[model samples]
Target: MDFASLMTKEISKAKPSDTKDKKETGSNNKYQRRADVEAARIAAYNAEQEKLQREREEKAALKRKHEEDELERRREREEKKRKLAEESRKKREAEEEAAERQRRKRLGLPELPPRASEEGTPVPEEEDIDDEELIKKLRELNEPATLFAETHKARLKRYRKLVKRSLTPQLSNGPIPTTLELVPEKDMKIPAKIPKDIDPESRKFLFRQLASYFTMLLEEWAIALAKRDTSVKESFSGRQAFNAMVQSRDNMRPLFKKFETGDIDHTVLEAIVEIVHCAQERRYVDANDGYLRLSIGKAAWPIGVTMVGIHERSAREKLHESDNKAHIMSDEVTRKYLQSIKRCLSFAQVRWPPDDLLQLMG
Candidate 1:
């Protein structure tokens, strides 16, 4: 073979290999470009997510700030309202004091002394009694525990005066002044039992008499309550008591109607008799307790029944007491009547705030 021909063959083989290498290089460049594009897309997506997260955090922070601001504004408004109310109350009290003083001056009465604590010297801390303790002491002395529009300081001062008055007896032969005068209760008898064979007209007349008697008793109770002092006679407390009494009188109308019709149950009749008798005797505490029994009933005790084991099943029924009063409120009509009676008792309690007279005697 010629030398030139052999050189040509080698060159041709080299040419094919070079072309193949160029194609592979182009493919690698294409793959690298695709990879770069994918990485850029992922970075953009991450940046968008980060931006959204930041925006959400900013909104949450702003919302919290708004709520905090609103709460602070509400507190400020309430505080302002309280301050205004306090100012108004003080102004009213001052005006009332001035008017009272002017009235006293016009009457040519001696100038009222300043309040104990209002004098140049403050009351000794040691002498300051808790309001509850002061109320209890006042009750023990048979004095009214509280008066309408009376402050704790005034109450304490009054209590001290009462204590001093009691401890120091007057050497002069003058009777001690008392705010409350005991009024004797008028005598009244409740029938032991309603006659089972009584005619409807007789029953109606009897119930009407009983209702009139009950009303009279309540009226007497109010008169006694208002005998405390001039201030008490016109006080809101006294008004409340009178209003409660009026409501109670209204409540008893339906009950008396039932009694007249002979539709009242025996338990109800017994309860009414007991309640009226207690009121008549001024055993208000007992009367209130009786009313509670009539209203709620004695079906279940304040103490709940204990669960018995299977072995003690026979003793389960024995655990509770058998009571006729349990079935007193058998029907809805009876329940309504009792509920009304309960309100009447509440009125009586308010009118004559029960004293522990029985306990004291025992």
Candidate 2:
């Protein structure tokens, strides 16, 4: 081959390679421009989306703020309406009260009592009120007449409070809840001891309440007797000789036996009431004691002597005049009996109006 021909062939091959490299470079430049354009478009789209989201958030915040303002305004308006209604109600009440006073004056009816002092009316310190009435009022108030160791003045004040509370239906119907103490069962073991930790004051208060309940039971018994036998009168009596009279009476066995058992059932209590009623009426004595030779139960304990006698040289000595007729049982046996009686008084269940008590006598 000629040298020129060889150079020409090599030049042609070199030219083709260079053209291919230029074409590749141009293609790469075009791809890079497209990538840049895509990146710019992605950035712009992201920015636009963020702007829209920000606008939506701002709009939501504005709406919430508007709603909050509306709620606040509504609350303020409601409060204002309530205040106005309250003021109007007060005005109406005052007008009605004034009209009532005028009407009372015109009708010659007794007007309402004067308002109490600004400091409040002071209750009278009178202790001369009837005990029955005071106690009855206390019972109605669901209060213990002897709850606290208060002075006569304080007691009177309590009574006044009861009266005031009675005016309010809610307070009167809703009785002051009192807790009942569950008495421990009497035990035979080692002379059962009351726990010292038990509050004595509370025990005493409970006993005081129980005493009232017992008295109520007695009253119910009396009422039962009245219903059972209309021939008897309600008269209070205390007698020592009656015990013998009761023991001697053949019919008294069943009734007195119940008391001995300390099983205070309605039937027994009712029977006792009848017995007491008959004795007070002098029916038992007249029916029995056929002859003077017959002594009912150990020559019949002494009769015709007044009890609760004042002993000589005692604090009550000056309180009573010397009367030989006045009788007293100061022996240890009598003292023990008194204690038992006191205990009995402290323990009584409340069952009133006969039939109701009959259901719960035990």
Best by lDDT: 1
Once model 2 is optimally superposed onto the true structure by TM-score, how far is the C-alpha of residue 351 displaced, in angstroms? 40
**Candidate 1: regions farther than 4 A off:** 1-188, 193-205, 221-235, 281-289, 301-356, 359-362
The digit string of per-residue lDDT tens for model 1 on 1-362 reads 89999999999989988999999998887666768889999999999999999999999999999999999999999999999999998899889888889999999988867645445575679988888988999999999999999988889889989988987733321111212122223434556456779786655555654555555545655566667787775889977766765655555556655644567766667777777767655677677677777776655443564664656544455436555345434666556556656665555555555465561111
Q: Quick one: best TM-score, which candidate?
A: 1
Clashes of 2: 0
User: Which sections of candidate 2 miss by over 4 Å?
Assistant: 1-21, 32-49, 104-362
All candidates: TM-score: 0.34, 0.27
lDDT of 2 at 104: 95
- Model-by-model lDDT, in order? 0.67, 0.46
Instruction: Give the clashing residue pairs of candidate 2, or none.
Output: none
Superposed by TM-score, candidate 2 places the C-alpha of residue 228 at a distance from the truth, in angstroms, of: 61
Clashes of each: 0, 0
